[model samples]
Target: MKKLSLLLPIAAIPVLVFADNKQMTTVTYLDRGNLQLVATEEPSSFARQITENTPNQDRRHTLENYINSLLKANAIYNHKEGKENPRLIYQIHANNEGTIIATRSEQGKYGVQIGNRSLPVYGINYDLQSDCSWQEQLCWVFYPSSNHQKERWLEISYAPHAIAELKEGVSLLIRNLQK
Candidate 1:
């Protein structure tokens, strides 16, 4: 009976490890070819900026709502949402190889989560121009300037809003994912 008890604990180790690693999710790769997402942060020379005026509280709230809806839709479709961890967004759109993860943990750090490491956001660019292949032109690109590696960087794309509103949405995603 003693051997049986020892074997039971050993078998449970894998389950416990998996439970602890539940935060890891399937990595979503950005299809640059399909989306036509350019890596430039500059305003398109041919296309004019959509809006120069800053977004007010209402506008920002609306943008956040839209982004949240998109996330919820994806989560629901994938059946990844749960009562314990309701908001299962972010971390889906990692870099090309899924090394740099987008994260906003419960402690309030916002940026990419690589492996077991967390970094902070230093710079984010919002390209709001009518130059996209699709109907919408609000392109949000996040370039997290981390000291981890100069050659390696991160790009997170999702956009269509005023600069302030885009920031709000990005903040919301980064915050919600790691929770």
Candidate 2:
């Protein structure tokens, strides 16, 4: 009976370790021949409240436009075949966590701030939940006439400094909207 009791606590060790560091996000990039489709999400309530007085569809569109502008302002670019300056569709879904999705082709030197330290993103794995893959379109489907392209995004969790930064951005956006 004593041996059984001791083993119970030992088995709980692994669960306890993983409970603190939950799998934050999985960025899926579907490559449809010429263009890439990257999808991720943000906190839905926060996104919806960004434009409080607007209609549901309009609010989502406005949020997507705002995020796309942020991407451009940060100099993040996505490429497409046969287009000099291709404008990719920024499909920002409302979900959980602040996630950044990137493929293997994206080897840009970006830095992340964790707490007081800023570290360069050198493809260093940090409990990545799943791998991203490119899939060839097998069937023709009805895509919206207005929106059909995909854009990349950024997400962060388990990092205090990064969360603080995101909060600051959200506060600034709200303040500006109030003005």
Candidate 3:
């Protein structure tokens, strides 16, 4: 009877291990910038964020909405809106230590989840006017100006091809986030 009980518990170990792996997600970390993301397996095209959020590079409402979403998310943790540092959207709780994950909805927007809240995720657009290598053009860079700022990440998928100058901007950002 003792042997059977020990064997039963051992058998359950493999099952539990496999279950945990199945629930694991794909997270990429960008070290230099100190950012991590479980990027949306299905990120919508940059054209979508531009057209859907605003018409023809209006930049007014689109920027405002994006700002509002950040403010909303930041407010949750910091308990202050607008004035507070906006990075709270992607920041994990001190207790939970959860992962930063970006998920795209059928509606084609990325809502990055941090702790218990989901904030709209946006990126800057790299215009590959001629040779567009990848489907995802919105290269979400951590340091836009290479200068330190409160709002580090921005979804600029509609402006220009400046970010395209950097090799694999998206991959670089993700890899550095881990460190």
Candidate 4:
């Protein structure tokens, strides 16, 4: 009985260690006014691999490559778009710890407004949440639209960890509208 008891405890240690390591990883990315969230057993590894594989080409191509790499890494979904410049827009990258936000917008037109400032029409918005606090970031891409193209503008808002807030915010917004 004494020998059995010692062996049982030793055998259980691996189980405990494995249980601790079984953590879920989730990654969120936004592109062309769309949002994609990916969950996996090894998120950091997947993200790093994808980012590394992307080519350091021109800014526009690089951005597209990055977004494409992320899409290949996991499932992707469309979020929303601003009414104006639909093509000119932004992308968002967010994890549980921090968020990286980037924006690409047309210049010399009606400016895009985030929070209160008049950002370029094409910009990226991000909301990051942690255990103790939350942060928001934005990036702007300034380029002029061609005269041949219709002067359309688009704004995108992305929050990987803000699903709960988004649901509540939408509900409240709609509720207030009904009133």
TM-score of each: 0.24, 0.23, 0.21, 0.23
Off by over 4 Å in 1: 1-55, 76-123, 127-143, 146-179
Tens digit per residue, CA lDDT, model 4, 8-46: 212111111123577655555555546655555633333
Residue-pair clashes per prediction, in order, are: 0, 6, 21, 10
lDDT of each: 0.32, 0.31, 0.32, 0.32
Q: Which 10-residue window of candidate 2 scores lowest in summed lDDT? A: 136-145
Model 3 lDDT per residue over 71-174, tens place: 23323222233343432332221111222233221111254333342321234222211222245433333432223342324333322343332223233222
- Model 2 misplacement above 4 A: 1-50, 76-179
Candidate that scores best on TM-score: 1
- Residue pairs with colliding backbones in model 1 are none
Ranking by TM-score: 1, 4, 2, 3
lDDT by residue (93-177, candidate 1, tens digit) is: 3222223243432211364233333333224223211211133322333444433222212212223333334344555434333
67: Cα error in model 3, Å:
2.8
* Pairs in clash, predicted candidate 4: 84-152, 84-153, 84-154, 85-152, 85-153, 85-154, 103-124, 105-122, 105-141, 107-143
Cα error, candidate 3, residue 143 (Å): 3.0
Model 4: residue 118 alpha-carbon error in angstroms:
17
The alpha-carbon RMSD values of the candidates against the true structure, listed in the order shown, are 21.8, 20.4, 19.7, 19.5
